[model samples]
Target: MAERSFHVARLPGFATMAVAVFVALYLPIFTLVAYSFNASNSMAVWGGFSLDWYAKAWANEQVKDATVRSLVIACFAAVISTAVATMAALGTTRRRAFKGQTFIYVMINQPLMVPEIVTAVALMILFGLVKTVTGIHGLGYLVLAHAAFCVPFAYLPIRARLEGMDLTLETAAADLYATPWATFRRVTLPLLAPGMVAGAMLAFVISLDDVVITEFVKSGGQDTLPTYMLGQLRRQLTPEINAVSTMLLAVTVVLLTTFFLLTRKKD
Candidate 1:
Protein backbone atom coordinates (compact mmCIF):
# COMPACT_ATOMS: atom_id res chain seq x y z
CA MET A 1 0.00 0.00 0.00
CA ALA A 2 1.08 3.54 -0.73
CA GLU A 3 1.98 5.72 2.24
CA ARG A 4 -0.74 8.20 3.12
CA SER A 5 -0.10 11.90 3.34
CA PHE A 6 -0.27 13.38 6.81
CA HIS A 7 -2.98 16.00 7.08
CA VAL A 8 -3.64 18.02 10.20
CA ALA A 9 -7.18 18.76 9.03
CA ARG A 10 -7.94 15.04 8.99
CA LEU A 11 -7.35 14.74 12.72
CA PRO A 12 -10.46 13.92 14.79
CA GLY A 13 -10.50 17.13 16.77
CA PHE A 14 -9.09 19.47 14.14
CA ALA A 15 -12.35 20.90 12.91
CA THR A 16 -13.64 21.41 16.42
CA MET A 17 -10.41 23.08 17.46
CA ALA A 18 -10.38 25.30 14.37
CA VAL A 19 -13.97 26.40 14.93
CA ALA A 20 -13.28 27.09 18.59
CA VAL A 21 -10.20 29.12 17.76
CA PHE A 22 -12.03 31.18 15.16
CA VAL A 23 -14.92 31.91 17.50
CA ALA A 24 -12.54 32.89 20.24
CA LEU A 25 -10.74 35.24 17.89
CA TYR A 26 -13.68 36.80 16.06
CA LEU A 27 -16.54 36.74 18.58
CA PRO A 28 -15.33 39.90 20.27
CA ILE A 29 -14.77 41.62 16.96
CA PHE A 30 -18.25 40.62 15.81
CA THR A 31 -19.68 41.86 19.07
CA LEU A 32 -17.89 45.16 18.74
CA VAL A 33 -19.09 45.61 15.19
CA ALA A 34 -22.60 44.72 16.23
CA TYR A 35 -22.50 47.22 19.06
CA SER A 36 -21.26 49.88 16.69
CA PHE A 37 -24.73 49.81 15.15
CA ASN A 38 -26.54 49.86 18.45
CA ALA A 39 -28.98 52.82 18.65
CA SER A 40 -28.94 53.02 22.44
CA ASN A 41 -26.29 54.80 24.49
CA SER A 42 -25.96 51.79 26.73
CA MET A 43 -23.34 49.36 25.45
CA ALA A 44 -25.13 46.27 26.82
CA VAL A 45 -28.65 47.18 25.77
CA TRP A 46 -29.59 46.97 22.12
CA GLY A 47 -31.84 49.82 20.97
CA GLY A 48 -32.36 48.80 17.34
CA PHE A 49 -30.02 49.71 14.48
CA SER A 50 -28.81 53.28 13.92
CA LEU A 51 -26.07 55.32 12.24
CA ASP A 52 -26.04 58.01 14.92
CA TRP A 53 -22.83 56.76 16.49
CA TYR A 54 -21.03 56.81 13.18
CA ALA A 55 -22.24 60.33 12.53
CA LYS A 56 -21.14 61.37 15.98
CA ALA A 57 -17.70 59.95 15.43
CA TRP A 58 -17.52 61.55 12.02
CA ALA A 59 -18.51 64.97 13.28
CA ASN A 60 -16.13 64.95 16.23
CA GLU A 61 -13.26 67.32 15.44
CA GLN A 62 -10.91 65.31 17.64
CA VAL A 63 -11.70 62.14 15.74
CA LYS A 64 -11.12 63.89 12.43
CA ASP A 65 -7.77 65.24 13.61
CA ALA A 66 -6.73 61.87 14.97
CA THR A 67 -7.74 60.07 11.77
CA VAL A 68 -5.79 62.51 9.63
CA ARG A 69 -2.74 62.28 11.87
CA SER A 70 -2.89 58.49 11.79
CA LEU A 71 -3.12 58.50 8.02
CA VAL A 72 -0.19 60.88 7.68
CA ILE A 73 1.99 58.89 10.05
CA ALA A 74 1.06 55.55 8.52
CA CYS A 75 1.76 56.80 5.01
CA PHE A 76 5.18 58.16 5.92
CA ALA A 77 6.12 55.06 7.91
CA ALA A 78 5.02 52.71 5.13
CA VAL A 79 7.02 54.52 2.49
CA ILE A 80 10.11 54.85 4.64
CA SER A 81 10.03 51.26 5.89
CA THR A 82 9.27 49.80 2.49
CA ALA A 83 12.11 51.66 0.85
CA VAL A 84 14.62 50.63 3.46
CA ALA A 85 13.40 47.05 3.42
CA THR A 86 13.66 46.84 -0.34
CA MET A 87 17.23 48.00 -0.31
CA ALA A 88 18.10 45.68 2.53
CA ALA A 89 16.43 42.72 0.84
CA LEU A 90 18.25 43.40 -2.40
CA GLY A 91 21.60 43.70 -0.63
CA THR A 92 21.15 40.45 1.22
CA THR A 93 19.60 38.22 -1.46
CA ARG A 94 21.07 39.40 -4.75
CA ARG A 95 24.58 38.28 -3.86
CA ARG A 96 26.42 35.15 -2.87
CA ALA A 97 26.07 33.89 0.69
CA PHE A 98 28.63 35.40 3.04
CA LYS A 99 29.56 35.60 6.69
CA GLY A 100 27.04 37.29 9.02
CA GLN A 101 24.14 36.96 6.55
CA THR A 102 22.15 35.31 9.33
CA PHE A 103 23.30 38.02 11.67
CA ILE A 104 22.07 40.66 9.27
CA TYR A 105 18.66 38.99 9.13
CA VAL A 106 18.53 38.82 12.93
CA MET A 107 19.38 42.48 13.21
CA ILE A 108 16.80 43.36 10.57
CA ASN A 109 14.08 41.43 12.34
CA GLN A 110 15.12 42.42 15.88
CA PRO A 111 11.98 44.47 16.29
CA LEU A 112 9.81 41.40 15.77
CA MET A 113 11.76 39.28 18.25
CA VAL A 114 12.06 41.89 21.00
CA PRO A 115 9.14 42.80 23.22
CA GLU A 116 7.26 45.78 21.80
CA ILE A 117 7.15 47.47 25.18
CA VAL A 118 10.93 47.26 25.37
CA THR A 119 11.28 48.85 21.95
CA ALA A 120 8.81 51.54 22.96
CA VAL A 121 10.73 52.30 26.13
CA ALA A 122 14.02 52.37 24.28
CA LEU A 123 12.61 54.78 21.73
CA MET A 124 11.20 56.90 24.53
CA ILE A 125 14.58 57.20 26.16
CA LEU A 126 16.45 57.82 22.90
CA PHE A 127 13.95 60.41 21.78
CA GLY A 128 14.07 62.01 25.19
CA LEU A 129 17.81 62.52 24.83
CA VAL A 130 17.40 63.90 21.34
CA LYS A 131 14.69 66.23 22.53
CA THR A 132 16.82 67.53 25.36
CA VAL A 133 19.89 68.02 23.18
CA THR A 134 18.28 69.38 19.99
CA GLY A 135 15.05 70.88 21.32
CA ILE A 136 13.36 69.46 18.21
CA HIS A 137 10.05 68.29 19.57
CA GLY A 138 7.95 67.33 16.59
CA LEU A 139 6.11 64.55 14.75
CA GLY A 140 9.39 63.55 13.10
CA TYR A 141 10.34 61.48 16.13
CA LEU A 142 7.08 59.56 16.00
CA VAL A 143 7.42 59.05 12.27
CA LEU A 144 10.95 57.67 12.62
CA ALA A 145 9.99 55.41 15.51
CA HIS A 146 7.05 53.98 13.58
CA ALA A 147 9.18 53.50 10.48
CA ALA A 148 11.79 51.61 12.48
CA PHE A 149 9.21 49.37 14.09
CA CYS A 150 7.61 48.68 10.71
CA VAL A 151 10.85 47.75 8.97
CA PRO A 152 10.77 44.07 9.90
CA PHE A 153 7.14 43.76 8.83
CA ALA A 154 8.10 45.22 5.45
CA TYR A 155 11.38 43.28 5.15
CA LEU A 156 10.00 39.74 5.42
CA PRO A 157 7.77 39.92 2.37
CA ILE A 158 10.33 41.72 0.20
CA ARG A 159 13.06 39.28 1.14
CA ALA A 160 10.78 36.35 0.39
CA ARG A 161 9.98 37.84 -2.99
CA LEU A 162 13.63 38.41 -3.80
CA GLU A 163 14.51 34.87 -2.79
CA GLY A 164 11.77 33.29 -4.91
CA MET A 165 12.64 35.34 -7.99
CA ASP A 166 14.39 33.64 -10.90
CA LEU A 167 17.89 34.84 -11.66
CA THR A 168 17.61 33.94 -15.38
CA LEU A 169 16.13 37.25 -16.43
CA GLU A 170 18.71 39.18 -14.48
CA THR A 171 21.51 37.08 -15.99
CA ALA A 172 20.05 37.66 -19.43
CA ALA A 173 19.96 41.39 -18.81
CA ALA A 174 23.60 41.38 -17.80
CA ASP A 175 24.51 39.28 -20.82
CA LEU A 176 22.72 41.80 -23.01
CA TYR A 177 25.05 44.52 -21.60
CA ALA A 178 22.38 46.12 -19.42
CA THR A 179 23.73 48.08 -16.48
CA PRO A 180 22.83 46.90 -12.95
CA TRP A 181 20.56 49.85 -12.36
CA ALA A 182 18.76 49.33 -15.66
CA THR A 183 18.34 45.63 -14.93
CA PHE A 184 16.88 46.35 -11.53
CA ARG A 185 14.63 49.15 -12.77
CA ARG A 186 13.31 47.17 -15.72
CA VAL A 187 13.41 43.52 -14.81
CA THR A 188 13.74 43.14 -11.04
CA LEU A 189 11.45 45.97 -9.96
CA PRO A 190 8.38 44.85 -11.90
CA LEU A 191 8.59 41.36 -10.40
CA LEU A 192 9.23 42.77 -6.94
CA ALA A 193 6.32 45.21 -7.12
CA PRO A 194 3.71 42.88 -5.65
CA GLY A 195 5.84 42.08 -2.60
CA MET A 196 6.74 45.75 -2.16
CA VAL A 197 3.06 46.69 -2.24
CA ALA A 198 2.16 43.92 0.20
CA GLY A 199 4.93 44.98 2.52
CA ALA A 200 3.84 48.62 2.40
CA MET A 201 0.25 47.72 3.16
CA LEU A 202 1.29 45.53 6.08
CA ALA A 203 3.59 48.22 7.42
CA PHE A 204 0.87 50.82 7.05
CA VAL A 205 -1.61 48.69 8.98
CA ILE A 206 0.92 47.99 11.74
CA SER A 207 1.76 51.66 12.10
CA LEU A 208 -1.87 52.70 11.98
CA ASP A 209 -2.88 50.23 14.67
CA ASP A 210 0.14 50.83 16.89
CA VAL A 211 -0.55 52.29 20.34
CA VAL A 212 2.38 51.41 22.59
CA ILE A 213 5.14 52.96 20.52
CA THR A 214 3.02 55.89 19.48
CA GLU A 215 2.00 56.48 23.05
CA PHE A 216 5.61 56.49 24.18
CA VAL A 217 7.10 58.49 21.31
CA LYS A 218 4.41 61.10 20.69
CA SER A 219 4.56 64.62 22.05
CA GLY A 220 1.71 66.46 23.74
CA GLY A 221 -1.40 66.95 21.55
CA GLN A 222 -0.09 64.37 19.05
CA ASP A 223 -2.81 61.76 19.15
CA THR A 224 -3.22 59.25 16.36
CA LEU A 225 -6.50 57.37 15.94
CA PRO A 226 -5.51 54.38 18.07
CA THR A 227 -4.17 56.62 20.81
CA TYR A 228 -7.28 58.75 20.55
CA MET A 229 -9.48 55.68 20.94
CA LEU A 230 -7.40 54.55 23.89
CA GLY A 231 -7.83 57.93 25.54
CA GLN A 232 -11.59 57.80 24.92
CA LEU A 233 -11.76 54.31 26.42
CA ARG A 234 -10.06 55.61 29.54
CA ARG A 235 -12.55 58.47 29.88
CA GLN A 236 -15.77 56.71 28.78
CA LEU A 237 -17.22 53.70 27.04
CA THR A 238 -19.42 54.74 24.12
CA PRO A 239 -20.87 53.28 20.97
CA GLU A 240 -19.21 56.14 19.16
CA ILE A 241 -15.94 54.43 20.04
CA ASN A 242 -17.40 51.24 18.63
CA ALA A 243 -18.31 53.05 15.43
CA VAL A 244 -14.78 54.39 15.13
CA SER A 245 -13.41 50.89 15.73
CA THR A 246 -15.69 49.40 13.11
CA MET A 247 -14.56 51.97 10.59
CA LEU A 248 -10.95 51.25 11.44
CA LEU A 249 -11.66 47.52 11.07
CA ALA A 250 -13.16 48.16 7.66
CA VAL A 251 -10.02 49.99 6.56
CA THR A 252 -7.79 47.17 7.83
CA VAL A 253 -9.92 44.51 6.13
CA VAL A 254 -9.87 46.35 2.83
CA LEU A 255 -6.11 46.85 2.88
CA LEU A 256 -5.45 43.23 3.86
CA THR A 257 -7.80 42.02 1.12
CA THR A 258 -5.95 44.09 -1.44
CA PHE A 259 -2.64 42.82 -0.11
CA PHE A 260 -3.83 39.23 -0.35
CA LEU A 261 -4.99 39.74 -3.94
CA LEU A 262 -1.68 41.31 -4.86
CA THR A 263 0.44 38.55 -3.29
CA ARG A 264 -1.68 35.57 -4.28
CA LYS A 265 -0.19 33.13 -6.72
CA LYS A 266 -1.33 33.72 -10.29
CA ASP A 267 -2.61 30.37 -11.55
Candidate 2:
Protein backbone atom coordinates (compact mmCIF):
# COMPACT_ATOMS: atom_id res chain seq x y z
CA MET A 1 0.00 0.00 0.00
CA ALA A 2 1.18 3.54 -0.78
CA GLU A 3 1.98 5.83 2.13
CA ARG A 4 -0.63 8.52 2.82
CA SER A 5 0.46 12.16 2.92
CA PHE A 6 -1.24 14.47 5.41
CA HIS A 7 -1.56 18.21 4.69
CA VAL A 8 -1.44 20.61 7.59
CA ALA A 9 -3.77 23.60 7.71
CA ARG A 10 -2.45 27.00 8.69
CA LEU A 11 -4.30 28.74 11.54
CA PRO A 12 -6.55 31.68 10.54
CA GLY A 13 -5.19 33.85 13.38
CA PHE A 14 -1.60 33.11 12.36
CA ALA A 15 -2.32 34.09 8.75
CA THR A 16 -4.08 37.28 9.88
CA MET A 17 -1.17 38.15 12.21
CA ALA A 18 1.34 37.57 9.43
CA VAL A 19 -0.62 39.84 7.09
CA ALA A 20 -0.85 42.54 9.79
CA VAL A 21 2.93 42.40 10.34
CA PHE A 22 3.61 42.71 6.61
CA VAL A 23 1.22 45.66 6.26
CA ALA A 24 2.79 47.43 9.23
CA LEU A 25 6.24 46.85 7.80
CA TYR A 26 5.58 47.63 4.10
CA LEU A 27 2.63 50.03 3.99
CA PRO A 28 4.83 53.09 4.58
CA ILE A 29 7.28 51.95 1.95
CA PHE A 30 4.45 51.54 -0.55
CA THR A 31 3.15 55.01 0.29
CA LEU A 32 6.58 56.55 -0.17
CA VAL A 33 7.01 54.91 -3.56
CA ALA A 34 3.56 56.05 -4.60
CA TYR A 35 4.25 59.65 -3.61
CA SER A 36 7.47 59.68 -5.57
CA PHE A 37 5.24 59.93 -8.62
CA ASN A 38 2.99 62.62 -7.14
CA ALA A 39 2.60 65.80 -9.25
CA SER A 40 2.21 68.15 -6.30
CA ASN A 41 5.01 69.11 -3.89
CA SER A 42 2.98 68.09 -0.83
CA MET A 43 3.78 64.66 0.62
CA ALA A 44 0.34 64.03 2.09
CA VAL A 45 -1.90 65.15 -0.77
CA TRP A 46 -1.47 63.29 -4.03
CA GLY A 47 -2.10 65.40 -7.14
CA GLY A 48 -1.99 62.71 -9.80
CA PHE A 49 1.09 61.05 -11.37
CA SER A 50 4.02 62.87 -12.96
CA LEU A 51 7.79 62.41 -13.40
CA ASP A 52 8.59 66.11 -12.83
CA TRP A 53 10.20 65.58 -9.42
CA TYR A 54 12.60 62.97 -10.76
CA ALA A 55 13.67 65.32 -13.53
CA LYS A 56 14.17 68.15 -11.05
CA ALA A 57 16.14 65.92 -8.72
CA TRP A 58 18.36 64.90 -11.60
CA ALA A 59 18.95 68.55 -12.52
CA ASN A 60 19.90 69.62 -8.98
CA GLU A 61 23.65 70.34 -8.89
CA GLN A 62 23.98 69.64 -5.17
CA VAL A 63 22.39 66.27 -5.69
CA LYS A 64 24.95 65.42 -8.36
CA ASP A 65 27.86 66.57 -6.19
CA ALA A 66 26.61 64.73 -3.11
CA THR A 67 26.00 61.54 -5.09
CA VAL A 68 29.49 61.58 -6.61
CA ARG A 69 31.08 62.15 -3.23
CA SER A 70 28.98 59.40 -1.66
CA LEU A 71 29.99 56.90 -4.35
CA VAL A 72 33.64 57.87 -4.03
CA ILE A 73 33.60 57.36 -0.28
CA ALA A 74 31.69 54.09 -0.56
CA CYS A 75 33.98 52.63 -3.21
CA PHE A 76 37.25 53.45 -1.41
CA ALA A 77 35.93 52.43 2.00
CA ALA A 78 34.53 49.18 0.67
CA VAL A 79 37.87 48.25 -0.91
CA ILE A 80 39.88 49.15 2.20
CA SER A 81 37.47 47.48 4.65
CA THR A 82 37.08 44.33 2.51
CA ALA A 83 40.86 43.93 2.18
CA VAL A 84 41.40 44.35 5.92
CA ALA A 85 38.54 41.98 6.71
CA THR A 86 39.84 39.27 4.35
CA MET A 87 43.23 39.42 6.09
CA ALA A 88 41.64 39.41 9.53
CA ALA A 89 39.41 36.46 8.63
CA LEU A 90 42.38 34.48 7.29
CA GLY A 91 44.50 35.24 10.34
CA THR A 92 41.85 34.14 12.79
CA THR A 93 40.61 31.13 10.87
CA ARG A 94 43.87 29.68 9.49
CA ARG A 95 45.81 29.85 12.75
CA ARG A 96 45.42 27.21 15.46
CA ALA A 97 45.78 27.26 19.25
CA PHE A 98 46.60 30.93 19.35
CA LYS A 99 46.54 33.03 22.49
CA GLY A 100 43.60 35.44 22.83
CA GLN A 101 42.15 34.42 19.48
CA THR A 102 38.59 34.96 20.68
CA PHE A 103 39.56 38.33 22.11
CA ILE A 104 41.06 39.34 18.78
CA TYR A 105 37.87 38.34 16.98
CA VAL A 106 35.74 40.38 19.39
CA MET A 107 38.00 43.40 19.00
CA ILE A 108 37.66 43.21 15.23
CA ASN A 109 33.88 43.19 15.60
CA GLN A 110 33.66 46.01 18.18
CA PRO A 111 32.05 48.39 15.71
CA LEU A 112 29.10 46.00 15.39
CA MET A 113 28.77 45.42 19.17
CA VAL A 114 28.71 49.16 19.93
CA PRO A 115 25.87 51.47 18.93
CA GLU A 116 26.35 53.58 15.80
CA ILE A 117 25.59 56.81 17.68
CA VAL A 118 28.32 56.07 20.21
CA THR A 119 30.80 55.21 17.47
CA ALA A 120 29.84 58.36 15.56
CA VAL A 121 30.31 60.55 18.62
CA ALA A 122 33.68 58.97 19.39
CA LEU A 123 34.80 59.34 15.78
CA MET A 124 33.57 62.92 15.68
CA ILE A 125 35.68 63.79 18.74
CA LEU A 126 38.75 61.93 17.43
CA PHE A 127 38.52 63.42 13.96
CA GLY A 128 37.88 66.90 15.29
CA LEU A 129 41.11 66.70 17.26
CA VAL A 130 42.98 65.28 14.26
CA LYS A 131 41.61 68.03 12.02
CA THR A 132 42.58 70.75 14.49
CA VAL A 133 46.17 69.52 14.28
CA THR A 134 46.52 68.30 10.69
CA GLY A 135 44.39 71.00 9.02
CA ILE A 136 42.92 68.33 6.78
CA HIS A 137 39.33 68.69 5.52
CA GLY A 138 37.62 66.65 2.83
CA LEU A 139 36.35 63.14 1.99
CA GLY A 140 39.46 61.55 3.55
CA TYR A 141 37.98 61.60 7.06
CA LEU A 142 34.67 60.22 5.82
CA VAL A 143 36.44 57.38 4.00
CA LEU A 144 38.45 56.38 7.07
CA ALA A 145 35.41 56.50 9.38
CA HIS A 146 33.31 54.47 6.95
CA ALA A 147 36.05 51.86 6.52
CA ALA A 148 36.24 51.36 10.27
CA PHE A 149 32.46 51.06 10.54
CA CYS A 150 32.17 48.60 7.64
CA VAL A 151 34.99 46.23 8.69
CA PRO A 152 32.86 44.00 10.88
CA PHE A 153 30.12 43.74 8.23
CA ALA A 154 32.66 42.58 5.69
CA TYR A 155 34.45 40.31 8.19
CA LEU A 156 31.51 38.07 9.06
CA PRO A 157 30.87 36.82 5.51
CA ILE A 158 34.53 36.20 4.73
CA ARG A 159 35.06 34.33 7.98
CA ALA A 160 31.96 32.23 7.41
CA ARG A 161 33.12 31.38 3.89
CA LEU A 162 36.55 30.38 5.18
CA GLU A 163 35.01 28.23 7.91
CA GLY A 164 32.66 26.48 5.46
CA MET A 165 35.45 25.74 2.99
CA ASP A 166 36.69 22.17 2.67
CA LEU A 167 40.29 21.61 3.70
CA THR A 168 40.78 18.43 1.63
CA LEU A 169 41.79 20.40 -1.46
CA GLU A 170 44.19 22.58 0.53
CA THR A 171 45.76 19.52 2.19
CA ALA A 172 46.13 17.85 -1.19
CA ALA A 173 47.83 20.97 -2.56
CA ALA A 174 50.28 20.83 0.32
CA ASP A 175 50.97 17.15 -0.32
CA LEU A 176 51.72 18.04 -3.95
CA TYR A 177 54.42 20.48 -2.76
CA ALA A 178 52.45 23.70 -3.39
CA THR A 179 53.82 26.71 -1.48
CA PRO A 180 51.57 28.72 0.85
CA TRP A 181 51.26 31.55 -1.64
CA ALA A 182 50.64 29.11 -4.48
CA THR A 183 47.99 27.26 -2.54
CA PHE A 184 46.22 30.44 -1.53
CA ARG A 185 46.40 32.04 -4.95
CA ARG A 186 45.50 28.95 -6.98
CA VAL A 187 43.17 27.01 -4.72
CA THR A 188 41.79 29.15 -1.92
CA LEU A 189 41.33 32.40 -3.79
CA PRO A 190 39.30 30.85 -6.58
CA LEU A 191 37.00 29.21 -4.06
CA LEU A 192 36.71 32.29 -1.86
CA ALA A 193 36.01 34.85 -4.62
CA PRO A 194 32.25 34.75 -4.09
CA GLY A 195 32.58 35.59 -0.38
CA MET A 196 35.02 38.42 -1.05
CA VAL A 197 32.67 39.91 -3.65
CA ALA A 198 29.75 39.59 -1.28
CA GLY A 199 31.73 41.24 1.55
CA ALA A 200 32.78 44.14 -0.69
CA MET A 201 29.18 44.70 -1.81
CA LEU A 202 27.98 44.59 1.79
CA ALA A 203 30.62 47.12 2.84
CA PHE A 204 29.74 49.39 -0.07
CA VAL A 205 26.02 49.41 0.76
CA ILE A 206 26.67 49.99 4.47
CA SER A 207 29.00 52.90 3.75
CA LEU A 208 26.68 54.41 1.15
CA ASP A 209 23.57 54.23 3.34
CA ASP A 210 25.30 55.51 6.50
CA VAL A 211 24.00 58.88 7.71
CA VAL A 212 25.07 59.07 11.35
CA ILE A 213 28.82 58.58 10.83
CA THR A 214 28.86 60.57 7.59
CA GLU A 215 26.98 63.49 9.09
CA PHE A 216 29.19 63.51 12.19
CA VAL A 217 32.51 63.11 10.35
CA LYS A 218 31.90 65.28 7.32
CA SER A 219 33.16 68.84 7.02
CA GLY A 220 31.06 71.80 5.81
CA GLY A 221 29.63 71.32 2.26
CA GLN A 222 30.60 67.63 2.31
CA ASP A 223 27.11 66.19 2.12
CA THR A 224 26.55 62.64 1.01
CA LEU A 225 23.12 61.72 -0.44
CA PRO A 226 21.69 60.67 2.94
CA THR A 227 22.97 63.82 4.66
CA TYR A 228 21.73 65.98 1.80
CA MET A 229 18.35 64.28 1.98
CA LEU A 230 18.23 64.92 5.73
CA GLY A 231 19.03 68.58 5.15
CA GLN A 232 16.25 68.83 2.55
CA LEU A 233 13.74 67.22 4.90
CA ARG A 234 14.74 69.62 7.66
CA ARG A 235 14.54 72.83 5.59
CA GLN A 236 11.65 72.03 3.24
CA LEU A 237 9.32 69.20 2.35
CA THR A 238 9.01 68.32 -1.32
CA PRO A 239 8.31 65.46 -3.70
CA GLU A 240 11.83 65.89 -5.09
CA ILE A 241 13.08 64.42 -1.86
CA ASN A 242 10.67 61.57 -2.38
CA ALA A 243 12.01 61.06 -5.91
CA VAL A 244 15.58 60.82 -4.61
CA SER A 245 14.45 58.55 -1.80
CA THR A 246 12.81 56.25 -4.31
CA MET A 247 16.01 55.95 -6.31
CA LEU A 248 18.00 55.18 -3.17
CA LEU A 249 15.38 52.64 -2.14
CA ALA A 250 15.68 50.90 -5.50
CA VAL A 251 19.48 50.76 -5.35
CA THR A 252 19.44 49.48 -1.79
CA VAL A 253 16.91 46.78 -2.63
CA VAL A 254 18.94 45.57 -5.61
CA LEU A 255 22.21 45.44 -3.66
CA LEU A 256 20.64 43.82 -0.61
CA THR A 257 18.92 41.21 -2.78
CA THR A 258 22.23 40.38 -4.42
CA PHE A 259 23.86 40.13 -0.99
CA PHE A 260 21.08 37.84 0.22
CA LEU A 261 21.33 35.58 -2.84
CA LEU A 262 25.11 35.39 -2.57
CA THR A 263 25.02 34.49 1.12
CA ARG A 264 22.28 31.88 0.84
CA LYS A 265 23.13 28.24 1.68
CA LYS A 266 24.20 26.00 -1.20
CA ASP A 267 24.25 22.23 -1.21
Strongest candidate by TM-score: 1
Listed per candidate, the RMSD to the true structure in angstroms reads: 1.4, 2.8
Tens digit per residue, CA lDDT, model 1, 1-267: 234878788889999999999999999999999999999998899999999999999999999999999999999999999999999999999999999999999999999999999999999999999999999888999999999989999998998888989999999998999899999999999999999999999999999999999999999999999999999998889899999999999999999999889878788
What local distance difference test score does each model get?
A: 0.95, 0.92
| Clashing pairs in model 2, backbone N/Cα/C closer than 3 A | none
lDDT of 2 by residue, 140-186 (tens): 99999999989999999999999999988898898899998999999
Task: In model 1, state the lDDT of residue 27.
Answer: 100
Error of 1 at 150 (Å): 0.7
- Number of backbone-clashing residue pairs for each candidate, in the order shown: 0, 0
Show the lowest summed lDDT stretch of 10 residues, model 1. Answer: 1-10
